[model samples]
Target: MDNMVSTCPICHQPTSPEWYFCPNCGKELKAKLIKIPLITQIGIYALSIFLPPLGLWPGIKYLGQKSQEAKMVGIVAITLTIVSSVVTIWLTFHYLQSYLAIYNGLLTNPSGLSSF
Candidate 1:
């Protein structure tokens, strides 16, 4: 097996590529970069913006992976999903309350619409 070695920027010490922090300096190591296709990122963001709840599945999946970009997209997707859900629920409740008010008014005065 090949032991890959890397230099730490903070301590200027040799460290293993797999190490998460520098042994000598205790500085955090940079995560290995994972390249994701541009199209995939766009698609993920598009789904997140259009269908936030559905997008959360992909977001959570990516978040569990090691890719930093994927994790970022996942966070954004989760945020958008929560915001969208809140707005939708608020709007639905508001509209339902308005509908109930109209229904109650009609029930209280059946002749209310007779003039119309």
Candidate 2:
């Protein structure tokens, strides 16, 4: 009977079945599994677009992985989150500035209200 064995990609050493890591070179023997599922990916995208702050967790998780697809999703989610945050801050500052200007005008010209 012939015995079956696998070889390590890094060191080319014969490895037994069911071994996850190469004993000779310490490289992982198993193929990297897709950690992020389709439904979860869709949810991440949706959260990034609608609720940016909540999307950060999945974005960071995906970014930490080795998969290129996950990295792309992570980058997109992070970019959207940052863009949303910046837009929110800018809008808030602009509206606040407008309110302050209106308040100042009211204070300086109390009779301005009569023109309305």
Candidate 3:
């Protein structure tokens, strides 16, 4: 069983690669951004357009992180959510208005369909 371990620079204590902070001295082990691929970004943005609530997960996740790029992505995600919500609402209202007009016409004259 090869149990290889690395030492922390600050406290000379053994640390595992997966550990972000040195357990003995609280030294930061590694600082890196969790990268998101371009395809995934496009998918998230697409989800933002289709299923807005589902799309908000990435934005909320990135916004709470401590990276500038992540924050920017989060801001963009939230903006897309807002914009999509507004567009969805507007489209719903527009369609509903048209449907109600047709329904009212049907109520006024049930025999109008035979003319077509």
Which candidate number would show the highest TM-score if scored against the true structure?
3
Q: Residues 3-112, candidate 2, lDDT per residue (tens digit)?
A: 36678878889987467688888887656655568888888988987787988888998898876568878998888888888888898899999999999988998996
Per-residue lDDT of model 1, residues 51-88, tens digit only: 76787898898888786567887887778778887887
Q: How many backbone clashes are present in model 2?
A: 0
Write candidate 3's Cα lDDT for 1-116 as tens digits: 32357789898888886677888889887666566677877887888878899779988987887755567678888889889999999999999999999999888988867788
Q: State the RMSD for candidate 1.
A: 8.1
What TM-score would every model get versus the actual structure? 0.60, 0.60, 0.63
Q: Report lDDT per candidate.
A: 0.79, 0.81, 0.81
Give the TM-score (vs. native) of candidate 2.
0.60
> Could you tell me how far off, in angstroms, the CA of residue 75 lies in candidate 3 after the best superposition?
0.9
Off by over 4 Å in 1: 1-32, 36-39, 111-116
Compared with the true structure, the alpha-carbon lDDT of candidate 3 equals: 0.81
